[model samples]
Target: MTLQTQLVLRALLRNPAHEMYGRQLADETGLMPGTTHPILLRLEQAGWVTSRKEDIDPHAEGRPARRYYRLTATGAAQAGAALAKARRPRTTALRDLAGEGGTL
Candidate 1:
């Protein structure tokens, strides 16, 4: 996956049970809203994530309902595995250079 895609996945994976609005996710992932929301839409289209309109009284709150996103179990596992793989130590010559000890 692209690093940005992985970032979105990891952010959502952090709290699979918690629903987060696009703006909230953008903040948490340190990604621009443009970047974050598109990733979310892709995930939603793939059935890896789901979104809902917040169940609050917009008039009472004086604002529109926020759309909240959460990961599906399938997504959590898939993303968690990708994160784990990304975190694994490298065993290549590159690792001896830029990736590890030497400054390439």
Candidate 2:
């Protein structure tokens, strides 16, 4: 996965219950709205996130609706795995180096 997608997935996992709009995501990730929104749309297409229209101003008639996103169960699992893998140490490189010193 692209770093941008990974970052967005991680953010959703961190706040699974809270539905975040594109602008909120942009602010949190320090990414441009153009970049972040497309990633979110892709995630939604992949069934990783569910998006819905949110009415921010209940009293404002016909105000533009906001798109809110929440994580799916599959998404949660994927995000958890991604986060764990990101945190894991690079043991493969160390193992390869250790073999070179064996029986020396």
Candidate 3:
């Protein structure tokens, strides 16, 4: 995973039960929206995350409804394992892949 992807995963892992919106996550991760949104799209595509639009009327709220993201049960487990592995020392082959931001 890229460092940006890892940051997003780590943030989600910190509070897996709490659903956070895109901008919220971007702010928390110190990443720009251009970076964070695509990472979220990929994670959702991988079945590691799920999202839903906030169930409030945008007009009444005077803002767009936020799309909240959270990790699935399997995602939480997988993310923990991935993060652990990413923290460990790697062999030459794995190090090369890591440098390229390859997936776990």
Candidate 4:
């Protein structure tokens, strides 16, 4: 995964049970909305995330309805495993390289 993708995933993982709007995630991850939205779209398409439109009335709220996203139970488990793998020690990765006859 790209660093931006990792950042987005990490942000969601922080509070898997709490839904966040795209703008919230963009702010939290320090990524631009252009970058964040596409990542969210990909994650949603991959079934790693689910989203719903906020129930508030836009007219009454004086703003557009926000689309909230949250990690699904299965998604949480999958993301956790992926993040763990991504965080594995560099030494372990080097060992794998050596085993594969790759130079340091």
Candidate 5:
């Protein structure tokens, strides 16, 4: 997964029960709307996430209702696995040399 994808997935996973809008998700992930929206779309298409328009009256709120997103059961499991793997430490060249008592 790409960095953006990982960030978005983790953000959603953090609030598995709550639905978040695109802008809110972007804010939470420190990503601009341009990056966040596309990732949401792709995740929706892939069935990892789902979205729906909020049932609010625009006239009452004086603004358009927003779309909200949440992860599916399968998505949560997949994201959990991905995040676990991502967090694992990998041995790099520097680390390997250090292990062999070499200089940095």
Candidate 6:
């Protein structure tokens, strides 16, 4: 998966039950809306995320309806594994770099 996709997945994992809008996700991930929106669309298409239309302000003119995203079961599993892998200590590399001084 691409870095942006990974990031989006991770964010979703962090708040699996909380529906996130695209703009909020973009803000949290520090990605531009252009980049974030496409990634979200792709994830939704891939069955990793489910998107739904949210109630919009009737008073707001010309604004598009808001869509919220939530992680699918598969997505949650994948995100958990990814997070574990990312959090795993770099023992091998650290040991190699430390040479004789390192603890196995």
True lDDT of residue 67, candidate 1: 94
lDDT of 6 at 11: 84
TM-scores for every candidate against the unseen true structure:
0.77, 0.74, 0.85, 0.82, 0.81, 0.71
Once fitted onto the true fold, the runs of candidate 3 whose alpha carbons sit more than 4 angstroms away are 93-104
lDDT of 3 by residue, 35-101 (tens): 9999999999999999999889989999999999999999999999999988886577776876776
Using lDDT, rank the candidates from best to worst: 3, 4, 5, 1, 6, 2
Worst lDDT 10-window in candidate 4: 95-104
Query: Cα deviation of 49 in candidate 1 (Å)?
Result: 0.6
The CA-based lDDT of model 6 is what? Answer: 0.83
List per-prediction Cα lDDT, in the order shown: 0.87, 0.83, 0.93, 0.91, 0.90, 0.83
Off by over 4 Å in 6: 60-63, 83-104
Residue 64 C-alpha lDDT in model 5: 94
lDDT of 4 at 46: 91
Error of 4 at 3 (Å): 0.8
Stretch of 10 with least lDDT, candidate 1 = 93-102
Summarize candidate 2's per-residue lDDT along 18-82 as a digit string, tens digits. Answer: 89888888888888999999999888888889999975775576656788998998988877887
Root mean square deviation (Cα) for candidate 5: 2.7
- Estimate, for each residue in 46-93, the C-alpha lDDT of model 4 and write its tens digit: 999999998998999999999999998888889889888887768867
Which whole-number lDDT from 0 to 100 does residue 76 have in model 4?
Answer: 87
lDDT of 2: 0.83
Descending-TM-score candidate ranking: 3, 4, 5, 1, 2, 6
**On lDDT, who's better, 1 or 6?**
1
